[model samples]
Target: MTNSPKLAVRGLTKRFNDLEALSHIDTEIAAGEFISIVGPSGCGKTTFLRIVAGLEQASSGEIRLDGRPITKPGSDRGFVFQQDNLLPWRTILANAMIGPEIGGFGDKARVQATRQLLKLVGLEGFENYYPKQLSGGMRQRVNLARALAVDPEILLMDEPFSALDAQTREIMQTELMRIWEEGRKTVLFVTHQIDEAVYLSDRVFVFARRPGRLQEVIEINLPRPRSLAIKRTPEFVALVERIWNLIEYEVRQSVLEEMS
Candidate 1:
C-alpha cells in the first residue's frame, strides 16, 4: 500500500539437501502489476511463489512486501492453488465467507461482502450450491471469489486453471483479467502455459531449469483490456514462440540428464 513496489525478491534461493530448487531469484513487482513465472517442470516456479506466499522458506535472500520482510503468511496476500480446494461440505457462500468469518468480521458484514464477491465472480445465485454441484469452471470461480473475499493487496496464484478443459481455461483467463482490471490487485501468477502467460502478464519471467534462476524477463506490449482475439496476432505468436524455445531446450536437457 505504500509507495514501495508491491513485492520484491532479492537473492532468493531454496534447497532440499544438495538439490537447489531456486537460486538467486530477484525481481521487483510494481503495485497492481500482473506478472507470470514460466519454466519447465522442477525449475522452482512454484517454489518461488510459495516463498513469496510465506508457505515456504528460502535457503537464502529475502522477500519484502511494501519494504517489510515477509516471514509468514498473512491476510495481505491470498493464494489460489491448482486445485480449487473448496470445502465440499460447505455451500459456496459459506466457503467464500470463511476467511472473513475467521477474521472475526460480524455475520452481516461477512454475508454482504461474500455476496458482492460471488456477484463479481458471476456466482451470485449459486451461493447455496455445494462444490460438488457446480461444474469445474464454476467451482474455480468460487475459489477465486474466496481469495478475493479477503481483499488481499496481492494475489499469488499457482496454475489455478491447469485442471480445467481448454475452453474453460480460456474463459477463466478472460474472467480473471476482468476481475484483475476491476480490482487492480497486484498479481504474481505461476504457470507452464506460455500462451496463457503471454496473454495475461504485463511481464513474463522465463526461468532456467532446476535451481531455478530467472533467465529472462520479457515485456508483453500487447494492448490492455485484452481478450482472446489478441492471442492470434503475429506479435503474440512471436512472443509465445520465443518463450517456448527457451523452455523446450531446458525440458530436453532435463530429460537427458535424468535418462543419463
Candidate 2:
C-alpha cells in the first residue's frame, strides 16, 4: 500500500438541527484498502458514509478524495444502499448501466462493461430480467454491479447485505470477498454486524453511540484469500469476540443513558 491516503476524513461532524450525529472524526484510508464501520444504531455510521459519498453534507469538517474536498456526488465514488433500490422498469443489464448512462458514457463500451459487471456479480445470463423477477440476494448483486459499472475509485456501501436471509447473506459475503480481491477497490462499508465487519475488512472502525465518535480502530491480521471455514478458527473467533465486546459495551451504555 502507498503511504498516501486514497481517502481522508478530517475533523468530520454532522448535525441535524439540534441533533448532532457525528463529531470530529478523522481517518486516512490507503489505496486498495477495505475498511468497515460498526456501531450501535444511530451512531451516525450511515451518516458518515453518506457524507463521504456526497449524498449528505457534513455540518463541519472535511472529507477529501486524493486531497480534493468532496462537495457533491461524483462518478469517482459509488454508493450501494442497504436496500437494492434497483429500478423495476429496467432490465438487470439496463439497471447496471444506470451509472454509466448518468455519466454520459451510455455507449457500446459501457454496455459491454455493464455486462461484464453483471457477470462478475454472478448474474451473467439474467441480464434480461427485471428487478421484481429476482430474489433479494440477486437484486443486491445487481445493486453491486450497478455501483461498479461506474468504475469508481472508491465504493461506499451501507449495510448492503443486512436485508438478506442468513444463508444468502453468508453466500453474498463470500462473493463480495472474491470480487473485492479481484478488483481491490478501496471500500468503506457500514454494517451493524460485528462478524461481518471482522470477516470482510482490513481494518474495522468502531464508533461510540449517538453524537458518534471514533472509539477504536481494530486491525485484522488474519490471512486473506479467506474462506468461510476460517470463521470457525480460533483466531477469527477471537477477533469477532473482541469487536463484539467493544460494541456490546457501547450498546449497554446507550441503553443506560436512555434508561437514566
Candidate 3:
C-alpha cells in the first residue's frame, strides 16, 4: 500500500426526504485492497457503494477516487450488482465484451480481452452459452467477468453471490479470491454474510442499522491466499463471533423498529 488510499470516503451520508439512509460514514481503501461492508438490511451498504460508483449522489459527504472527486459514473469504477443482470439474448462472450465495445476499444482487442476475462473467471468454454443455460454460480461468474472486462481501477460488488445455493456460493467465493489475487484491483464488497465478509476481506467494516453508521472496521490478521479451511480455525471462528456480537444488537433494533 502507498501513503495515499486509492479511494477515500469522508463524512458520507445519504437521505431520501424523510428517511436518512446513511450517516457520517468515513473510510479509506488502499490500492489493491479487498474490503467488505456488512450490516443489516437498509443500512445503506448499497447506498454507500452507489455513491462511490457515482450512481447516486450523497446528501452530504465526499467520495474521492485517486484524489479526484467522484460525481458521476465512469468507466474507472466497475459495479457488479446482486443479480447477474445479463441480457437474455446475449451470449456469455458477447455480454463480457459489452463494456470494452461501448468504450470504443478496438474490435479485435475487445474480443481478446473478453476471452481472457472469461478464462480468468473459469468460464472459458462456456463463452457461447446463454444466461438461461447457466447455473446461478455460472451466471454470477459471467457477471464478474463482464465487470472485469472494463478494466476498472476499482471493483464494487454488492452481494454478487447472494442468490446461489450454499455449495455454489462457497465455490464462487473461492473463485473470487483467486481472481482478486490475480487481478489486484481495489475492491469494496458489500454483503450480509458474516462468514463471507470475514473470509474474503483484508478488513471488515461493520455497519449499524437504518441511517447506517460505521460501527467498526476490523482488520483481518489472517493469512492471505486463504482457503475455506481457515473458517474452521479457532482464530477465524473467534473473529466471526466478535463481529456477530457487534452486529447482533443492530439487527434486533432494526427488527423492533420494523415491527413497531
User: Each model's number of backbone clashes?
Assistant: 0, 0, 0
lDDT per residue for candidate 2 within 49-100, as digits (tens), equals 8898888998889999998999999999999999988889999999999999
Winner on lDDT (1 vs 2): 2
Report the error of model 2 at residue 28, Å. 0.3
Indicate the worst ten consecutive residues by lDDT in candidate 2. 1-10
**Candidates sorted by lDDT, best first:** 2, 3, 1
Query: For candidate 1, lDDT tens digit of each residue in 208-260?
Result: 96667999999999999997999999999999999998789898887888789
Return the TM-score for candidate 2, rounded to 2 decimals: 0.96
Each model's C-alpha lDDT?
Answer: 0.90, 0.92, 0.90
List TM-scores for all candidates, in order: 0.95, 0.96, 0.96
Model 3 lDDT at residue 35: 94
* Model 1 lowest lDDT segment of ten: 1-10
Off by over 4 Å in 1: 1-3, 255-260
Write model 3 residue lDDT over 1-260, tens digit each, in one string: 44798998899889899788889888888999999999888788998889999999999989899999999998899999998899999999998888887788748877988899999988989999999999989999999998888899999999998989999999999999999999899999998899999999999999886567898999999998899999999999999999999999888888888899
How many residue pairs of model 1 clash at the backbone? 0
